[model samples]
Target: MKHLADLLLLGDPRLYQSCEPVLESELPLVPDWVADLHNVMEEIRAMYQFGRGIAAPQLGIMKRLIYLNVDRPQVIINPELTAVSDEQDELWDDCMSFPNLLVRVRRHRSLTLRFRDELWRPQTWDVTDWGLSELIQHEYDHLNGVLCTMRAVDAQSFRWRPTPTH
Candidate 1:
């Protein structure tokens, strides 16, 4: 199999649409997706140097899925973020899916998402803070043909990318 980055992440209209349904009956084992996902994570890790979490859909997987974990970096999550605080916060965000651009996004301050573990057992988690929340929301948006820049919610407000600071 090719490296995950070899997979395209942009200019695909699918990345801009709702992800395909993920059947709960066949949730993948952690070993199944994690290794590939980890490779993708490592490939883009530098883009997220000060950031946390990334998702496959942003890499253009049209599945009801994502991977998320904060600064801890010990895990790769899928079908992530089932329960998010109805309460959301707005914050500035950068994305591996969208490099060099910073956009303001709205997300729950906390969440409880469900997914299978490495062995494929159903599980849930509570998450808070900007990284996890923002990442989940960002990736989730990809599932809906949406991008973080869309958070600006105005075509005019969207910028191609940011001017990097030295």
Candidate 2:
């Protein structure tokens, strides 16, 4: 039952540390972790109106786990990216960790994700859509201690998120 407050914010040292893989013996712990990730991500979506996925490190879990709920809920554990396309797309990327900032970064247009599920079953997803590709890559980077800010296109690739006027 984690909340938005439990999310690790930008500048937190733990957020920059590479995560460890979830062990088979730790499968029992994944449900609770996924719940926390889901709760926090939902809160981010409600407050900021944007969030497709989140990684375990974002909550200080220090594991290679990702919870994504676009059209449905998906649990990705120990994910590895493969078959990444050379084609790239540049976009303004936002993160729950730094809700008030955006980074312009280039990402591969497509990639294949291979990971284990909550039940420890191996799974693979071929992501080709630009939006989904970007989202997956963003979350994947979190597991490797890479942030969008670290991938910025240039010195001028950073900007404050525009506040909404009600």
Candidate 3:
């Protein structure tokens, strides 16, 4: 099982490489991968108190897979974004890869997410909520070797996350 310590950090070269699509023949391995992802995500949540989604590459899986647990657990495979709105919103986005930093970036206010479920069934979701939309976009960027730091609005858009008071 993968742990928080296995997570790829911000400066890892693998994090800058684009991921490959998960093949149909690889479906059998997805369960274990998702389990590891869930474990690491849970650890991130426990340590940093914020994490809604994580990509496979974050754990060095190097596949177009994302595990998201907002209202519930969701396994997204080879996701594609469509119907992205021209409207945008700026927010301080954080990542498990660099938990102590946040990047100010602009994201689409709404989008349509198309992907395969764990059963290899096609699924579509219209994400209109700003929070969910941004979360999905952030994860999708990972599959393309794009980091939140790359999307920063400006050089001054990066900030350290506030340390909690004991």
Q: What TM-score fits each model?
A: 0.70, 0.97, 0.98
- Over 48-160, each residue of candidate 2 has an lDDT whose tens digit, in order, gives 88899999999999999999999999999999997899999999999999998999999999999999998899999999999999999999999999999999999999999
Model 1: runs farther than 4 Å from truth?
A: 1-7, 23-32, 47-51, 69-83, 153-166
Error of 3 at 117 (Å): 0.1
Better of 1 and 3 by TM-score: 3
Rate residue 95 of model 1 by lDDT: 67
Stretches of model 3 off by over 4 angstroms after superposition: none
Per-residue lDDT of 1-166 in model 3, one digit per residue for the tens?
Answer: 9999999999999999999999999999999999999999999888888999999999999999999999999999999997899999999999999999999999999999999999999999999999999999999999999999999999999999998554
The local distance difference test score of each candidate is 0.60, 0.94, 0.96
In candidate 3, where is summed lDDT lowest over 10 consecutive residues? 157-166
Number of the candidate with higher lDDT, 1 or 3: 3
All candidates: CA RMSD in angstroms? 3.6, 0.9, 0.8
Model 1 poorest ten-residue lDDT run: 69-78
lDDT for position 116 in model 3: 98
**Best of the candidates, TM-score:** 3
Error of 1 at 140 (Å): 2.4
